[model samples]
Target: MKETYEEKINRRLKVKQRIIEVAAGREKADLVIKNATYLNVFSNEFLQGDIAVANGLIAGIGEYEGEKEIDVNGKIVLPGFIDAHIHLESAMVTPSEFAKAVISHGTTTVITDPHEIANVMGLNGIDYMIESTQNLPVDVYFMLPSCVPATAFDESGAGLGYKDIDSYFEHKKVLGLAEMMNYVGVINGDGDVVSKIIASQAHHKKIDGHAPELSGNDLNAYIAAGVYSDHECSTFENALEKLRKGQFIMIREGTAAHNLSALMPLLTKQYSDRCMFATDDKHPSDLLNGGHIDYIVKQALKNGADPIVTLKAATHNAARYFLLNNKGAIAPGYLADIVVADNFADFNVEMVFKRGKLIFDGEVKEFDAPSVDETLVEKCHNTFNLDEVTPNSFKVDGKLGLIGLVGGELLTRNLGFADKTDVENDILKIACVERHKNTNHIGVGYVKGYSLKSGAVATSVAHDSHNIITIGCSDTDIAVAVNAIRKAKGGIAVVENGEVKALLELPVAGLMSEEKLETVNEKLEKAKAEAYRLGADKSIDPFMTLSFLSLPVIPSLRITTKGVFDVEKCELLKDEMSV
Candidate 1:
């Protein structure tokens, strides 16, 4: 006879409890940790103590007696870091693989926005994320994608309406609605936007906001519309306004944007309660080097913010805002998800515990995560059409507006009229190729200031839409870059002087890889190195900047496969210089 899901869970819990009781009698705990200095995010205090775990929850924490007591005499114990906002797909690996790398860095929980996969595979993709993370030691909660394509102007792999969101909300793993990328809809009072928020609220879920350019009247309107948290504050004034308006300002540090330093100034001991830290979209390379939320905490401290305040933002604030009662604090009854680090500044995670079990002791241990099957791999086969093929397909006439990428910020500086009539040394080209729907809609336009020297860079990792964005000096390289991407299924590729310089294959939905996390990290590092070899010396991972170039939701200049867009006016134009 088959057992119900509830019954299975109950049985497991009962077994876990039984094991704990038996272990206690023997004066032996499943895991006995001693001499650990703990960071109390709740009280903002540090205490030298011992934690005892029997089953998967904190059986007891204080001075404890256990079967195996490993002395961590010189380590500072912290509540496992919680990433308030992240797209797991952006890591270029599956949840299990992503977990392995972060666990060592002391991140035990992730509040993922699977909007990337939602755009490509919809509910099925979400289901894949849910199922994959079920047995993993790390705790991963999800927010239902608020905006499918993120904007009405751009196209995506799929769409989820109110009913779709309502149905998904029934899943126990679903935490709240993901960032509502439709700021215009909220401020403008679009019926669809209102309805989605209402649906989430009806289910007692929190609404996440994504107000990129919103300020003054428009920003006020968004808050009134029920967005509780926002991570896109580009300036101190904007962050302050959002915080004052009762929204948790998630100071984001990610592959594309690093705003922790700028936002760190706002984190006073008093106001630190309303701030949280998140990796909005961390690529494999960044995750391996800097870490998940660990990077944010380190940067915050380096900027002269209080260590405990930064810790509170990373753990307690994020957990309390998301209403995750079971984890985030080192309190009785909370899940035994804790990290042992020597210092808060360095954040060297010596040992990590998720649900009381030692998942990572500076490395992966007995991590039996499931393998990615056909569905996860099959989801990558989005329609790709090349029927509108022309040798010089991305050629554009006259001057165009250039969407200038500001390193380490979500905000783009909109440069208007960058070129006039495609001057010899001032010509910039932006091309968007439809990667999902095989549409021959390859929108091309001239852009200025995004200086490219005779080569093309192509990526299917375009944000929200996951389309192919090709920018180059030569039309031949642009075409080669786009065609090369199609042949590899889905990935980011750079072609210069008729040779492929770099590529990162995202086999899963053409946005993430199904490979191991370490493998992905290695490839990502190689890709970045190669990009540098090909003259991309602007940012740490310029591929992330490349991905955002096609996101039309953000202000200033942007391009979709349809055409160049004035994000402020939300209109497509023939050229950026004309703007």
Candidate 2:
């Protein structure tokens, strides 16, 4: 008879038991740390005990003898945190490399959405992520990408039908379908949308949602379709409505959206069971400095959330919601993934353990990181049919309808049109180019409120599809911006006075960098400062704002490299300059 997956794992764990057995069995075992207190988030209590490990699981919870016992008499031991929702690709590093930054912060497990990569390369992208993360010290699980290309109406790099969802279910690491972004499709009874949800259910997987402005009956209908969670809730009332409707509201903090202060009030001990924390799309700088899920835990506690409640949100609640039964709590048979933190206020980590092995003791280790290839970075094509784009083709006249940008948010603020003014009206032009196929489909439109006095900003980090987006003061600047993007392979860049003003290189995937975390962060900070130097005075994170303008699913108004999209109406806005 063949052994089951559980049995196979147990057999291997038993062989790795010698070191742990010695630590727990003797009155001074192989490795013993004496005089430590444990914070049990499960029972909401602090217990005075020494935890013992054997065979990579929590073999004993009380005091024991170890071969080597160190006095850690003043430390606090807490279970390692789990990132309920995140996009690893957004970190701008391969999975193994990203581990080196987050592991020291005591993050032991992460539930990631490969949807960003899926949108650019589809199943192939997801396969690469799965293959790359399997053997790391951190436990990285996945959700089948819920919205490739985000929505059906727009032109994206890849699209998945029923076949793709079925294939994803075969991967044991796949937990569920990722966020269902096309809420309108679910409400309107689109067959393709319904099929994806049904397929997930058939595989015994939970469905995630991305309903930005849905509420009332429409929201209820989407929940009826089986999407149980959403990370796009912006307001308290909306979050309440969704929670009441049976959809778990993921309180999000990201490079673009900051919702912690607004949502913290709702996570009191009374309502804490249903809430969870997620960094939907954080940049590398924030992740490296402020911490990953650890940041969310501190912010929640400081804002009046009970420490136990916040821990549950970051651990158990998310694990249960995602149906990760073997994780979320520290128990006899759990994955032995745990963290020891300094205190409730600072939420500092003293050590991190995963699968019964010490990955970090709050600092660098001698463990070898898995080697990565340059293929994922080089995989994205930068070739565009420049032959079809003339200098005249980049300009548009008359009173032009424009997509408006709101600083500090992913959703755009709608601004109608420029009153038949010249290019001096600050009615900058925005374009999306198809870089994957060298398809010369460049969608052109006017954007208001950027406050860009004189230069053009271009980025390959366009949302969902990862196409190149350029918004600028003049056609000449626009041309220069795209050319620069091609020259660097890919990333965000600014062109002014026939010169490059600033850039953050994303040589990996033409959307990320293979550079060190500190190096990438420094470059991003410089680029942000340079954006203002080049005349974007309205927003702190202007380049990130520029990227979301191309996301077609969020709502109100958006533009893709393909065309101007009206997400509320789910159609292309008419070409008339008048709204």
Candidate 3:
């Protein structure tokens, strides 16, 4: 049975009455923390008070009595952290499992783009994510994927134009349009892309950005189209230029791209307000070992940044950016999402409160599991549609255009042309196998800096399209690795001597695992170790680096199911390569 509109109003009125009374100090609060030093984000100062909570909201932040009370005499209480931008699929675990991992580390709210899964399962994938993350300790919000296939050169499982996603703006948790990766579409006035931007603006929603090295009139045209933020800033000069142009910069520090160190100069009183924190993509090991938003905050503080300013960047700045009015503060009428830590130096979390209820006290407490739609689950569980691949599936005919890896960066260099796989020079064969519709259209090419001496590494976690991508010394090993991933439904596989060495299965839409974070991390560690032993690059995460090879939006050159693509020209290589 559902409550009528009138009944719903009455219920809300009753709750509001109690909140007003508690805030006025005429009635007892549901919970209170006494004698605590907390940051006042509004004033940018430290204050002491007895914080009161009632009906899952901060009733008051001054002297007040409560039915239940706890004292934190020396700890610093701050508003919970918010990740401005992230792809939940990058964690390689289910939403519930990802929530548990971050909540304990002080992340209470996250704005995620489901583009990874959306590229593989379409709208059904977005539906699956929303349904499966409900009623959790951490408040998960959605930024509907703005670029499903990302660009024209790639083939994704589905394509979402403005018409496909306009209705989602009305969803309670949906924030705005996600990263507009196709800056070309926006600048050149592509009808479908412009319509999506227009729709987001029509609803007065924030549109995220993904423009790298875009400047001058080209960048102005992009901003004029109404995109609000960007997380791809890898240099201080680039970030400052965008910030000057009125775009909020998200200082991204994730598994593959570490921009925080370079952009630390932005964490000042002059520029900190227009910035926020984001981990665009983080693997399981990085999440469990380093931390989440908490890691970024700690690193900032250690590097001599003002503690209050850093906290504001992690909390209030993001909340205000996404227009989450009731969050990112500790005051009357605000959501009671808070974190208590011993001090700023260590930033060790001692307790966490979500909506006025204690959820983590050194260890995470048990909570109700999220309810997922079984229909969507059934559809997402079986996304692989390719047939068995053979050695012939990976054979390239002539001279190749190689994708050269840039260590610790997502940018790649186009390493001109090569006649053959130069084993001594660390150049090897790379292939992208179309698995979505079983087209059996394999795009074969060569890569320069993978450094894999013998065995091949393969994954179904290819960017945007989630195809089967593998790199190896010989056609036999690449074929073996690709078939192993197909055999596991979808996963990462390593092959040496025509034998599968290690595997980590990601069966959910070939994007994430339903396993616990610990389980996933353990398996990933073993797989990474095997990859390194077989001579993969030690400076970068081999699997994560390989996943980006097919993303045509990045720069210079890329590979797709079609063939080697020149990103600058936006065309498949013809006379440039001996295909």
Candidate 4:
């Protein structure tokens, strides 16, 4: 018999009602994990018990009778990890593909921001992210994109206002509004942003914040807007101050920005509850090499946090901060999203369960590859719309405000270069091409510290807008790379000596690939190697760092279809001297 939606949650509710009966042995448990040393995140104690699961929720504890039971053999049981904040599109793969990569790493839940896609296709893009990730091994929740185009200085294919956000909130998967990236708007009370924030609050939804290096009255004003969490804190003092403001401080450690070591020094037991772990924009290559939240947990433990406290930060703290009901705990009313590991130091998962169903079994090292659902492949369509351009399109001369890319940092420095003489000093020209529309708008500027001695690297995965961004020492090579990307619809391209060295296609909104994680890794590694050979700094992921250059919200200087923007000043950097 087919089960109706009401019938399903009803049956689960009935099981919840019979929890007393099941615990008293009057009713049988659906499944019981026996003899496990489970970490009770509530009391912060390691206790041995048989965890009873029925109707996808924890029905009982202690010794229990069950229809079926599996002996855990004294393994450590902890709540499955949660990634409080992440950009699924940043993985350069679809949500299904991203799920396959991180599930085995012990993440059972992820609060994703589809702002990257929303900025490109609006609500349809947001719905696509929601519908495509259903029925996966992990539970995926979404936060409505607060800034579709990110900033007025840049251009995106679409923009989502209050009506768009209201419609998105109707979806059951949407938790709240995503990061309010326009901190300036939040502080000054821009109409559209204010309306959206009010709408979210009216719906009883929490808001996420993005205020980098903001402090004092500015931070206070932002907090007053009801932004409850922040994942953009990249420094110890900033994180601490945000925590002091009664905000959940998300410590981010991703491929492009490695802020964990800098922030771990502040993760004491007294302040553990206010801090959580997230990889806001982790690359698939990085996810494959280290892990997802589990890697962060290991790092926290190794950094001298008490094992229980560190694990709490990885799990319960995030769920609590997000107000995700019945998640991140080993309680009677909570979900059976649990992980079994042999050790806390370099914790290796032996089994994983989501909603009482085993999704991963055996040791983590014995992981089996998961196939991408072919039906989902239909969503991976191209969004690029621009035609080919000549080498002349990328030429930059005269005084330019060079965007100095700090290694492993989201912020850039506005360095002034009077002429092209800095090319000898390793400063390179960069441009943001308006790929969504064929208006041929290209914002050209110079960038320092890429260390590119030759060649060029380009990507259509430019943040928020998903435009095409190219960086190179040679205009000819830049043209070659951008043209190759246009032909591929969407991808990262490495052009050297006027030839394509490597390319990785991202057919979905010019941001994500349909390839399997392993295949994607292989192709991306080749492309990354080519970029490294072309003189990308060793300290950075050349492809990812390039994508963020067009994000005008992060710092001193950024490019858009309009022109370079002084982010803090919220004005054009045009009068400095146009190229």
Candidate 5:
């Protein structure tokens, strides 16, 4: 029998008394940590004290008695760091797996948008993710996907409107709206966008922002539509302007979108309070090696940021922005979700406690992650529906506009040139195959600076549309890579000379792995190695870099299932162009 909300409330009231008793010294705290130097995010200073925990909440601080005690020897203890915004799907792993990877890195809180999954499996997918993450050491919150298909131009598996997201608005774990990617609709006061915002506001939920490169009045217009936080500011001017306009700046350092270094300089004392740290879409390999939010903090510090300010942005600022009460503070009555780090500069997580229960003990061998619910996987049709694929399908003629790859960022430069076969010049064929409706639609073009001297990479993890996108020097290798992904149902593949070199299968609606985080990382690393062997430069993940060419939301140039897109003008290119 499922317990009602009233029953849960009554049970919580009973625990409330126990917590009060523990705080008053009448009852024993379940556990206590003594001699720890507090991060004290609330006061912006360090304090030395013992923290008392009972009923998964901070019962008291200073001179509290407990049944069990852990000594820290004055190590720095702060609220477990919070990742202000993230897309769990980008980790290419399930929610439980993503939690396992980041919990050890001291990220106790994550605000995620499951729009990618929703685009495939619809509302069922969102529900599956919600059920999948319950009772974990890390606290994962949801920002209901405001734009499932992203825009009208692309064909996604699902098209969610207000009805789809309305129910999740009041869910305690569902914070508010995800990034409102449809800034065009918001600016133009489109009814659909306005109604979605109204639904979130009616429920009093925080709206996350995703306006990349919008400046001045346009940015203000987007903000005025009720997006309170942004993780897509890719430039210093945009980041500062967003902060100036009262939109919380989420400095994102993700797998494809690396905006931290560019925006870190904006972490000035005067504006630091409005800033927060978020890895919008980090891959598992990067998460395992680079160390999640701690890695972001370390990078910000290396970029000459103020230590205290940086730490605040990493923790308190996010908590306050999301209104995660009883979090982001080392004070009485706050959640006893703390991270014991050896030092602030390195941010080496020694131990982590969620609700006073030790989750990560700084020992990898002894760790056990929360079990995932297999039933929560909203099974859908395999996302490979290409009617027929051939080497000839990838051929493009005339003046070609190529998405020029940047070394450390996602923003692409549009390079125009005549189509020709030149391996040295790095003019390679890029295609976005229609996967949703199987309209026999393919957007074929060429891209420069990809550095794929030979072979090809294909992925069904293409952004927003989640189409089958492939890039290759030769049509046969591209076909092989794409065929391998199709055989896997949905996945990423690297092919050379008509043979699959590396493949990572993402069978779950073509976007994420259902396997363990470690497994996904191994597969991704192997694929990345194969990409490098194919002459893909070490500067980027060729698979992911190719995947983003289909995301029309970013800027400059991109492709959708319909055709090649000039994002600035929102124009779709046709069959003819100057060569």
Candidate 6:
């Protein structure tokens, strides 16, 4: 039996009446925290009061009696942190596992983009992510993937047009369209891209942006197309320019892209209101070692940032940006998402409460896993369309353009041309095999700065398009690594001397694992050790760095299933380079 709409309204009205009664001191609150110093986001100051909760909502924040009370005499209470943008799949774990890892770190909400898995299974992938995150302690909202294949040059398993995802804007958990990586298309008024933007605008939803290093009329045109926020600003000048153009800047500090230090100057009172913190893509090791939004907040505090301003950026700014009005504050009629910490200096989170429920003290509260459709699970497990590859599949006989890696950045450089693999000078062979349709389309090229002297590394977690990207010194090791990923259905593999040295199987859409965070981090650590042992640069994260090489939307040079791509010109390089 289902409650009628009128009955539902009446029930909510009764709850609201109770909240009013509790706030007016006529009725007892369900729970209350006494002796608290909570952040007043509206005024930007630390105020002392008792926070009362009833019916999973903040009843009041003053002296109040309750059924249960917890005393925190000297602790600071805050609105639980909200991650402005992230990709849960990048952690290489299921949504449930991801929630478990972040809850203890005091992240009560996360706005994610399923573009990574969307490229693999399309609508089904998006559905899978939504279904899996239901009923979790952490509120996991979404921005519907705007660029499924990212661009026309890439071969993703599925392509999502405007029509394909227009209806998703109506979903309760979906905030709006995700990062519009195809800024070129939007500026040029590509019909499909424009249609998506118009649909999101029609629904009055926020459209996230991803135009890195764009400036002048191009940036204005992109903003004119209704893109509201960007997470790809690498320089402070770039972020400031975008900020002046009426765009919110999502300062990204992730496992790979470290843009926080460069943009930390924006954390001042002048710009903090329009700025938010986002990890964009965090790996398992980083999550376990550092934390989530708490990590970002702590970093800002250590760098002499104003504590209240930084805290507001972590909660209020993001909540306001995404239009979650009830969140990011500890006011009456707001959700009772709260965090208790020792102090601002150490920033040690002691307990976390989501919707008035104390879900984390030292250990995370256990809950049932969100039930996903078994059929969808099966489909995700069978994502790899290619069966196998041989040494001959990786041979590229021509003058090759090399992708030079910039340390600690997603930006790559075009290092002119190379006639062959220069292993002595730290150049290695790289390839992106089409694993979606098995067209046997393998784009072979060379990369400098990885400095792998022996074995090969391969993964199914290539960005934008989840293709099987492998790099090695020899053709045999590269083939063996690719075949290992294919045989495992989808995973990352390390090979040397025609044998697998280490592997981390991502059975879920070949992008994430269903395992817990600790297990995935352990396996990833093993694989990383092997990569470093084989002479991978110790300065950067090897696997995470390799995964971004095939992303064509970033800049300078990239590779796809077609061949070496010149992103600025938007064409595949052929005979333009000679030895």
Which candidate gets the maximum lDDT versus the true structure?
6
Number of colliding residue pairs in each model: 10, 14, 0, 0, 3, 0
lDDT value for candidate 4? Answer: 0.84
Against the hidden reference, what TM-scores do the models get?
0.93, 0.91, 0.98, 0.94, 0.95, 0.99
Better of 1 and 6 by lDDT: 6
Candidate 1 clash figure, as a count? 10
Clashes of 6: 0
lDDT of each: 0.77, 0.75, 0.91, 0.84, 0.83, 0.93
Model 3 lowest lDDT segment of ten: 570-579
Question: Over the stretch 1-579, how does candidate 2's per-residue lDDT look in tens digits?
Answer: 999999999988775565455444643333344565766767777677666655555656677765455456777666777787888877776677688888888888888988877777777778768877887888888988877768865566688887876878868888888888888889988898889899999988888888887898999899998899988988888888888778787888777788888787668776778888888776777877888888888888788787778888888788888887767776555556777787887778778877757778867465565544556434644322234344565765654457776656677755765533234565778888777667677877788767677878888888878788888777777887787777777788887876788777776556667677778788777777777876675554777777778888887788775677888878777666444
List where candidate 4 sits over 4 angstroms from the true fold: 1-14, 17-20, 363-380, 421-423, 575-579
Candidate 2 residue-pair clash tally: 14
**Residue 323 in candidate 2, Cα distance off native in Å:** 2.2
Model 4 lDDT per residue over 1-579, tens place: 999999999997776678767766688888899998998988889988899988788887888878989898758999999998999999888777788778788899999999998888877787678777877778899999999889876688888888867976767788889999999999998888889899999888879988889899999999998899888888889888988988888888887777888888657777888888989998887788899998888887888878888888889998998788799999888999999988876588778988888878853323333443444444447567788999988766657667888887989998865356255688888888998878899888788888888989999998868889988988899999999999988899999999999999888888888788889889999999998887888888898888888888888898777667789889877645543
User: Compared with the true structure, what per-residue lDDT tens digits does model 6 show for residues 28-79?
Assistant: 9999999899999988889998899999999998898889999988999999
Ranking by lDDT: 6, 3, 4, 5, 1, 2
Clashes of 4: 0
Could you give the candidate ranking by TM-score, starting with the highest? 6, 3, 5, 4, 1, 2
RMSD of 6: 1.0
**What would the per-residue lDDT of candidate 5 be over residues 1-579, giving only the tens digit for each residue?**
999999999999999999999998888899999888887776777888889999889988888778999999858888889988888889888777888889889899999898888887778788877887887667899999988788888778889999778988978899999999888889889999878999999998888888888887888788888989888888888788888889888988878878887887778788888989988888888888888988988888788887778888888889898888778888888988888888756768889998888888865323344554565443643555666577877776675566777777777777754366578888777888877776888877777778889899999998887989988889888888877887788999999988898999998888888788888889988999999998988887777787788888877678777667777777775444422
Of the pair 4 and 5, which is ahead by lDDT? Answer: 4
Q: What's the TM for model 6?
A: 0.99
Q: Which ten residues in a row have the lowest lDDT in candidate 2?
A: 380-389
Per TM-score, the best of the predicted structures is 6
